[model samples]
Target: MSATLYYFDGRGKAEIVRLAMAAAKVPFTQVDIKEKQQFETLRAEGKLIFGQLPMVEYEGNHLVQSCSIARYFASKGNFLGSNEQERLKVDILFEGTRDFNTAFMPYGFLGFKEVLDNAKNTAMPRYLPIYNFILSRNGSNGHLVGSKLSLADLGLLEVILTIEELLGEDELKPYPEVQNFLKVMKSNEGLASYLRSDLRRRKNDERYVAEVKGVLY
Candidate 1:
């Protein structure tokens, strides 16, 4: 089946889907809409569902929403879960990470000192402990669901990376399980290669960061 992903040039909401597909060794095309006008054009043309990005076309099926896309690719790659119970567990953590993303996005985009401080003081304290507890409950195995890696782990890895970026690499020291979890996910050869690749590095450009800050601030 042919697969293509549409998102902004940066690694915002779409990173999880890309990571899942890459980890599963699924070859897919990534179309980066680098400008606001391009996105507006696509939306105006009714080419994007839900009037937003991070959409995917797989086997001729168009999917909207980032988490939905990630879950679909995860299922396709056999990284979702083995059974109903495991799937439920994976969904719980995945949704939790989504919630964390929703809460933390403003901090990243706003790019204000106060916003960063608020996230570090309020959001991180409130959310990180919950994730830490979940990881601990799962035997601190670096996998949020079951004994093996799943979509939940990939989602959490994204969350952890974002937190580290916003705060610092040392911020996760308070949550050792989460730190370990990040390490394990990053150690995956496919994921590591993708992380080190030009596609990932180019997303960190100053222009994109400035654009996000300009729009939100």
Candidate 2:
């Protein structure tokens, strides 16, 4: 089946979806809307669901929401889980990453030193410990669900890398399991290649950072 992902030019919410597809060796077209005018035009045309991005057109069907789209691709690639319980474990960690992103994105967009400090001091302490615990429970094998790779792993990897970029390399040092998990995920051939490819944007690209800051401030 043919698939095309629609999102902003930068990584943002769509990176997990792209990572999943790439890891699974699934071929699909990526449509990056680089201009606000293009995004507005698509929204005005009523083509985007929920008036937002990270939508996927798969086999003529439109799927919305970043997590849902990523899950769909994971299912298609057989990276979800082998059974019901495993799927639940995967979902829990996947949703946890989403919650972490929800808490982190606002501070990122605020683009102020105080906001960053608050996140570093308060929010990270609250959330990272829980994520670190989850990783420890799973043996910190770089896979968040079962003993194999899942969408949860990809999701957590994105969040971890984003946090590392915003904070620093040593930000996850307090969570050794999480740090090990990051190393394992980055060692995957497909993910490693994608990270080095032109398709992947630097986490702190000024253009995307400025765009987010402008929208918030």
Candidate 3:
């Protein structure tokens, strides 16, 4: 399916789905909502089911919500897991990322050290250890579910990348298993290419930040 993702010029909530799509080796184009009017227009036209973005027009369906789009891509990519139990594990891990995303979104958009500090100090401690443990328990195999990669793995990479962008790359030093998982996943050709390409925004852009603040603030 030819997927068209609508979001801001930067990654925002769209990154995970993009990463998943990339990993799935599916081709999708980005429609950057660089202006407030652009998003407003889509909402006015009822293109957005929830009047919000990170929406994907895929296979003749307009998929709204960040996690829903990611889940769709995961399902299409066979990354949600191979079995019921494994899929549940994927959901669990993905939910952790979603939780962190909800909590840290303000800081991500505003670039506030105080907020980032609170999340890094409070939330990171609680979440990172569990991720580290999960990876470790799974033999630190870089896959949170079975032997192959899944949404859990992609979600972890997305979270780790965000932490790296805000807290610096060395932030994962305390959690070697999670850190190693990041390293191992980066070796995937699709993921690596996306990471190194302009298709993926590795760091939040100031202009995009201003646009998001202008619209949502």
Q: Of the pair 2 and 3, which is ahead by TM-score?
A: 3
lDDT of each model, Cα atoms only? 0.77, 0.77, 0.82
Off by over 4 Å in 2: 204-206, 209-217
- Where model 3 places Cα greater than 4 Å from the true spot, the runs are 108-111
lDDT of 2 by residue, 59-143 (tens): 7777788888888788877887899999888888788778766655654356546666776877678878987887788785767
Return the clash pairs for model 3, or none. Answer: none
Question: lDDT value for candidate 2?
Answer: 0.77
The best candidate by lDDT is 3
lDDT of 3 by residue, 93-151 (tens): 88987786655667645557777888877888888999898888998577788888898
TM-score of 3: 0.92
The local lDDT score (0 to 100) that residue 139 gets in candidate 3 is 87
Q: Which candidate number would show the highest TM-score if scored against the true structure?
A: 3
Q: Write the per-residue lDDT of candidate 1 for residues 45-116, one digit (tens) a residue.
A: 776778877777787777888888888778877887889998888888788777776656554356557667
